[model samples]
Target: MEIKEAIALIHAEGLQAGTWADLGCGEGLFSVALAHLLPPGSTILAIDQQPVKPLPYSIPAGISVMRQQADFSLTNFQLPALQGIVMANSLHYITDKPNLIKRLAQSLTDDGTFIIVEYETTQANPWVPYPITLQALTELFREAGFTNTIKLGERNSVYRSGKMYAARISR
Candidate 1:
């Protein structure tokens, strides 16, 4: 199926996360959006190795945005007890992808889900992320410890130009 079609399949199921997270959140778009995806009173933890950047300052009230400057590759720091969703967009920027995800997966509750969005290799942008195709999103999540994974379909990714793809993985 088309990449966008695949991602749409994932997002359409809707977000059931109570406490969500977006690891490696660069600009915070995916993190912010996922925060909005949750039911009211839900919290989202937006963790990044980079220092927090200036966002609109004005954000949704219920969402608890947590920023982490520590390197996620290190097996240090406290993982959150999350019963919601976690997302990763364009993870190719990660130097230690496996370790980084192992830490992230450790945070997932049995009821939680992990959403990943990456570009289809053929359509990946050459300037960003060394242009690695986001198609291996499933394998990456499996390596991270997601036992139950399903192709959630693709959508025209706002994350990039060509096509925005998405996948849903869970414990």
Candidate 2:
């Protein structure tokens, strides 16, 4: 989905402000978009395994953006306590999804939200190491102690003809 659509969906979900993170933020598009959606003075940590280039758009006032280079799949990596986290088109690359999800959950505040955008198919490929269906994702989050999960939005995948879904999981 487009960044605007994703931002609109996040706004509709009552996400007004907080310390947000965009894990595996490739070009920082969503990270920038989120900065605009959040309340003033909120911070966004845009992290990626590879170095991320500077954002193309103008940052809104009272928002701080921090760029970090780290491999999230590594067990030694640490995450700060956050009010919200977004993993868009990135979780599929991890081989151990359950562990990562659990670790991410632990890093969140009590009422924190986790947003994910992923393929809806169960098929696996080289690029998608751990293809997880929507049902499976919900189950995984439930197993990880997330009590509330919502399907925020869905659209046809630009990489393929299949469908993709954006979900929100909260503790």
- Give the alpha-carbon lDDT of every model: 0.62, 0.83
lDDT of 2 by residue, 54-142 (tens): 87767799999998998887888888888889888898998789999888877888888888888999888777778888898899999
The top-ranked prediction according to TM-score is: 2
Q: Each prediction's TM-score against the native?
A: 0.70, 0.91
Kindly provide the TM-score of model 1 when superposed on the true structure, using C-alpha atoms. 0.70
Report the error of model 1 at residue 167, Å. 1.2
- Report the lDDT tens digits of candidate 1 across residue range 68-167: 5654546676666876544455465665667767776667786777777666665434445533355466676666667766665555655455765566
Clashes of each: 12, 0
lDDT value for candidate 2? 0.83
